[model samples]
Target chain A: MSTLSEPPKQSFHMGMLLNDTRYRGYTFQFIALLALVALFGWMVSNAVANLAALGQDINFGFLSDQAGYDINQQIIPYESTDTHMRAAFVGVLNTLLVAVLGCILATIVGVVVGVLRLSNNWLIARLMSVYVEIFRNVPVLIWILIVFNVMANALPSPSTFRGDDATASMLLGAFAFTNSGVYLPLPLWLEGSIVVVGVFVVSLIAIWALRRYARHLLYSEGRVIPTLPIGLALFVVPTLLAFFIMGRPIALEYPEMGRFNFQNGIQVRGSFIALWLALSLYTGAFIAENVRGAIQAVSKGQTEAAASLGLRPGRIMSLVVLPQALRVMIPPNISQYLNLTKNSSLAAAVGYMDITGTLGGVTLNQTGRSFEAILLLMAFYLAISLAISGIMNLYNNSVKLKER
Target chain B: MKNSLLLGAIAVTGMVAGAATADTLQEVKDRGVLNCGISTGLVGFASQNANGDWQGFDVAICQAVAAAIFGDANAVEYNPVTNQVRFEILNSGEIDMLSRNTTWTFSRDVDLKLDFLGVNYYDGQGFLIPTELGVSSAKELDGAKVCIQKGTTTELNVADFFRVNNIEYEPVPISTASEAQQAYLAGTCQVYTTDASGLAATRASFEDPSAHVILPEIISKEPLGPLVRHGDDDWGDVVRWSLNALIAAEELGITSANVDDLAAAPTDNPEINRLLGTEGTLGEMLGLPADWGVNVIKANGNYGEIFEKFIGENTPIGLARGLNAQWTDGGLLYAPPFR
Candidate 1:
């Protein structure tokens, strides 16, 4: 028979909040929180006091003021008389455009170079290693400056295409190459073009569905299908059929030589080209290293087992190696995307009218609203980085390894 | 305890930030150096020499101000500011004065709370183009791409110029004059726009200076001057009269060579005697020594000497004194009376 003995019950008292072990930890935490809140309150008040003393109050009315400036490349409508808010929005679009373009180009280059760097061919592997070392070791700013200089200096001027005895001529009689920029024919969308675009979209989805089915058949029924050839057929046939069926609703407006520049065409400015390519090449090098590490992280036995099962080398890689490597590779790759978006602030150096160049630049200087403009810029970059992280995490979830 | 310490630091930092808003003159005196802001490099305006000493047209103004305050021309700390951060740097008290080619405008003076001392260079915007481009008039420059320095009035003037002419032109905003020069030479931009004097300075540095021509268009009046933040009128008067002394010395035929002779004692010319601190108590009004004008003139000679030494026609800049001459010579450079 066990005799139960009750320990001495301590009475609840006000002193127990600090002396008792259970409450002491919480008491310290509460004190810390109180101190933190007080600190934050003090900082805000201090800033308000300092600004007031300078005869300046925090105001964002300047956003409605005229920008009084012009942008080199604008994706939306803008004028010197436009409000700063609209100008900032145009800057936002340009920044997004470069970031999106840079991400796509970096992924393509990083994946190709990463796979090639692991090749048994010594020359190819060594060359990729050299490229990664050179591009990543130096700062991104230097690469941007170098690429901008090369684009401007190496390209011929428009005057070279002028006279009968011209030293240079337009390529393909439609594309004009000049240091000012490359002049490409503008695409004109007429009536019924929307139907053609819809058809093209439908065909792309169909191709994706067919590929999924092909994979299903291979796994479940031991069947093989030539998905590439059939997917090409599915992609091309309907798009062409819809285009002709829509009565040729698209046309090209070729650039015509004006007195000073090529008028009536879209100019892909050198500044954009320089910033996009430089950011891609620099960030692609780090992504290459990540891919290389991720590939090696998957044990060698997996590859050997696939080889013994009579799988072809290319099929073994596509089916077994890269899919597993992607999970390990994605987290670090997400950070690279963040780095690229932030580094694009350096777009001002190359004269690319990205958000930093316009809003954080001329608008800040002209309106003398450096504080408000910078706060908005910081908010934008922070929002973009979080959004990128969230999108990448969702992608990571899809390839996550399953465990019981 | 750690968080409390951090909060204490935050409090101290706030007080310090607010404390720097005024009494800039005392701060400079305690530091024993005059902080002067200038452009990164504009060869004839502000740049470092072979001896690693800062020397140029704008540099001269800095030296004069420093000499007026410290009685030593070399008691200066040069802060090179870009087009984007000049005003912020000045307002933050990192630089006591900005001697860069900053224009005096209504907004910059009253709205931005800056006190412009006086105009040192009277400039106007103009266009520089390749000679063989066959473009004579700026109105003919329709559809041309322009490379211009942002944060200056040049871009606004060019935009207004083309808008008034009913022509469409693109502006490639560049950071510095050197990069703009590279873009212009590479033909990436069909035109480069800035002050006419700056265009001349840039052309003189070109490989083939004759291959380019400056378009005759004075788009906007840019009265470039030195400036200080408001609430320091004592320091402002010190800087203002230093500039006046330079201009008056030029009008009174007192060069750097004769400054010592003129300041030895009272001269026959009463204005010269007063300006050189050899008569009356003019320097006392500005809280400087009786020999304040001597220090200023000895720092960089008179305004005409400085202009001729750096950017006059005799120099490679080849800028003729069209509107920068003294009023006696039918120009607009007239200083206020000293007495």
Candidate 2:
């Protein structure tokens, strides 16, 4: 009887009038949205007016025009006469190449250092700690400069390194290091090698599927298989078979020493190598800290419980710790990847012929289209960053812990 | 509230009036200084000395402009800009004029809306290779790794030269001249390509200058000059004619040593008298004093004097005035009549 009466008494007060306090919150939110929209609209209008005053039009039609420039160290086929759009495509591909390579190398280095820092050996742990602290504290720009300068100044001239029978010299034959750049052997592919590559890729996919199936079998039936040896066999068998079947199609093209320098081999300019190494090492140091923090966040009790169940130390780590820690590690790691991609624009400083170096620097100066060029550069960076974040979010969702 | 609104309206009107009356010349005069943009550490062009004083061929031009405007050459602020940022700095109105070694191109003049004053240096793209290459000409540099500075015409010229010659070459592009030099020295590239003057400057800084040889090939013409923004025709004329005065003074043999004497007494040539402010109102036409040209010549000795002091055969650059010689000497450098 008291509960029923209390309900009616509360309803009577609720029906008295409309609430002004709740409406005030909605009014404030509406004002904030309007202010933000107005600010953006005003900015757009100002930009249009300024461009008009300067007799410049904001259009992307120039993207289809000839680039009329050459880029060094291209992984894809590009010529000086290619369209500007195509040139930017090449830049995007190069940027992805560096970012992906840097991410892989950084992850390996970070994991090793992170694990070593917690090792039982004091010397090893302290060494890794020192490395992390030193690299993380220094600005990446200084490291890039130091690496580039030392590589340029301390390397040998090609003339000194060139010889047919050159051995036991400062560097290998047809190879030299200098403050300017580095010369290395470039691989020349023989004809009909695509078949072998296709076979190799297919074999890799088969091996991956097999491993997954084996893991599933182990989980359901409590029966374990030797996955490592089987996977190795699966990889080697197909690759070796394809090589023999295709008559061994790939060949190495060693740099030949000419009169003044090496010729006919790919050369990695010192700037590219130095910048790539600096970005990787600096970002790796921060990644090491993130990895260590993530691993430590996993509860000790989980590991102990696994140990009580008679599981091996490696198995305990693989089954209990890593899966949990990866959830924590991935978000920060994604940020590092984005940072590496964005920081690649610093290639402009060293003249690596990246997008920023070509379109933003030379193309802008040569064409005098600053507004268009800068806008394109900004869009490129933003798209790359957003793509990386989107992929990382998908991975995060896949690995997230589920609870009932 | 009404009173405060009235006060705000009055303040807004006052601010608009103030802006409407603001002229660039008056602003610069009131500031008592002129901002000049220059390149970073080019040996004969623009470089700072050990005592931090900026001095070079381009620095002399900046000084003359300041002298023409303020009557005091020291009333100038030097802003060092890199090749990548020079134009942007000028476009943003961060500097009054860009006296850097910028190439005058149709795109820059029309598309960028910049007014190029006049050519200061007539340069050409060339190749520098180690002497041991035994390559006598650029035609033999097939399959060579050529180090090129990015953001310059050198990159385009390299590709065109190789393409037209039907030769295949690998390009090793870099950003700064110093980087290109370092790469060429390091054996990262078989050849370094840039302006002939830049090649000479880089070679002069090397310990073994004799080890390298500049290839005898002029691939493309690079007429380097100073530039100012568009929309300010008055300012543009002042800068353009100031450069013209220096060149004309060189042609007339009117240098700093004899500028005063010439200014005091009339010359037999009518054009000389007008140039020296003794006859016509050439300076007055540009809204300057009658003796503005004389002041400019007095400030920096003449184009010839400035060139000899900085990059002549006696200097480390040791550049011969081959194509840069006066029109009378069969070179391309020619100034219009002062009148």
Candidate 3:
């Protein structure tokens, strides 16, 4: 004790770890981290011991084995003779396909419905409300089942289109809708098809350039250009001209009745349609609510200020409020997209060979590698979710309030 | 304090190790109920009746096992498992054994570490299609969508047969038999393939059974039976012999009606005497009551009786025993001696 003037020279003591304010936080944090690490270690060791006792070891060698199964929709050419790794890749592609399609459709439908929900028309607003409430409140699994069952039962079998007195017929003698799937005429890429495709791509770029140029002209010299009609003409005329110049090289291969069913065309399997439509409709409702809330969150002052600026109602919404509301809408929108992506696992109910259906399903069952399969499945989803959040967060940072 | 923390971890490890080595039989006895996995629905094999009580060829095995373990046939928690989850359920110990129509395979038995008790039903894969398809042979099914139940040997067999025959068929894999039936009936698929027995059962459940025909293509040998997890040889023996007792009971002419009387005293037949636990201490060797076989027989009768009651030629399923008959009757069922 040195007269208590310098706190006894602040001597280090074991008790100080808990009693002293300066070290307490670090001490507690170290203890918590130790407990967490120990817990994880215990869990992992317990699992390993139990698995060994059951005469199983964690092995992912099954991925190299033959899949020996068929997938309904394959973006890549996959035979039953392909390896399980290839099968999983096909599953990943299918999962991505539905997620991408669902996100696009849901965004479009959600924005429209969300806008309509705030409309002055009582009937339209109420109808939009009814749509959101009915769809969002119900579980997505039931929707998937409903869509799959309706498609399977309500649609006629291809056999019905066989006889002279056919009960069902193809649509416009081109698209065939049956219980199995919808078939559309596939475009045959001929020698000059590339030229036609190139011309279309060029016309699309031209339209985009024209819009930018019109914006520039409007800003630099207050000249109004009817870019919509010009852009439309640019979209169609050049492509049509190139097609005729290339002698209409793209021919259509119509699906005709083969020995068993309609063959030789693009058969959009019913499983894909059921899963895609169900996910889109279900996730669209939640997105609609998000959009409506986000749009409303934009201060009434902003809308009034735009109106006072002599801008039209549509112009005020598009130019002033929506861009600002988007800042509020993005985080929840990311969550909805993630939900749609993950909910696509319900594809198994309808036998759509998404990642869950293949890797977590047939492959897991066949290989009897539940632990390894589930571990991989979780890792894949984690990676995907992190990537989605990372990208969306970057976009969020870009669109949010910035320092001047 | 550190000692206490270390002790807690040790205790948890001990608990996990203890669970791994836990005797399935003793667990079932302590719980007073046997968890038995069966198919979601295969009419004559494992489907439920109108009264919500399970009555089928497969359900009888569950009941018999429960009877052997608890002496009450009703002491069974029936777990309806899909093809995708049957092996997993068995391995997870959620069920003592899977009585579902699972085919015994090399990878499943060796790699997956399952113990197939014995072949309960000898079957072969076949296709069932509508009678109006105007096609008779399975070989003629080209470019057709085939509705198949996924996660079974049947899944692989279909792919194999199609490849070998140089045919192109689209596989529409569904999960449960009920779903497959719905898809097949709704015209989503031109062909539905599974065990011939399963096909008969599915057809019989149909409102118009006459509208379907089983194609004459027996693609693969499907030796479906009850199975347990590997390891725990003692419990494995109990389940294995439980199945064998039913099979042997049929061969020894032990009907459920006469089982009790025959079990009361030693019979002239030594095999029957040993089986009924009147002569030997085999039941004690299996860690059970000496009269377990008698309980099993009284629960579901013999194998033939169960077959007749559920899926025999007399039933709506109308399946003849075929290769499932006793060895004396020139079929494949040959149970090991009770001794």
Which is the leading candidate under lDDT?
3
Interface RMSD of each: 1.6, 4.0, 1.2
Assess candidate 2 and give its TM-score to the true structure: 0.90
Displacement of residue B311 (Cα, Å) in model 3 is 0.7
Interface RMSD, prediction 2:
4.0
What C-alpha lDDT, on a 0 to 100 scale, does residue B166 get in candidate 3?
88
Candidate 3 stretches with Cα past 4 Å from truth are A1-20, B1-9
As for candidate 2, its clashing pairs are A152-A178, A152-A179, A153-A179, A155-A177, A180-B182, A180-B183, A181-A270, A351-B175
Clash tally, candidates in order: 0, 8, 0
User: Per-residue lDDT for B107-170 in model 3, tens only?
Assistant: 9999999999898899999999999887789999999999999899998999999988989999
Chain A TM-scores, per candidate, are: 0.94, 0.85, 0.95
> Residue B273 in candidate 2 has what lDDT?
91
Model 1 Cα lDDT, one tens digit per residue, B1-339: 787888788788866775655576677778989999998988789878899888889999999989987899999999999887898888888899999999999989987778999999999999999999888899988888898998888888887888778888999889899889988888878899998888998999998999999997788999999999887888898889999999989999989999999889888999999998888998788777889899999998999999999888888888888799999999999999878
Task: Please provide TM-scores, in order, for all candidate models, with all chains considered together.
Answer: 0.94, 0.90, 0.95
- After TM-score superposition, what is the CA distance of residue B158 in candidate 1 from its true location, in Å? 2.1
Model 1: residue A291 alpha-carbon error in angstroms: 1.8
lDDT tens digits, residue span A1-404, model 2: 67866645333343233355645676678887996897678567667766676677788788788888777767789888888877877777777777787888888888778767777799998999999999899988888887877776676655555565543253555455544566577766688788878888998998999989998998899888988898899898988888788898977677666655556667677777887898899889988998889889999999899999889987987788878888999999999989988888887666676778667766776676778888889998999899989999998989988766
Deviation in angstroms for A175 in model 3? 1.0
| Order of quality (TM-score) | 3, 1, 2
Question: What DockQ does each listed candidate score?
Answer: 0.66, 0.52, 0.73
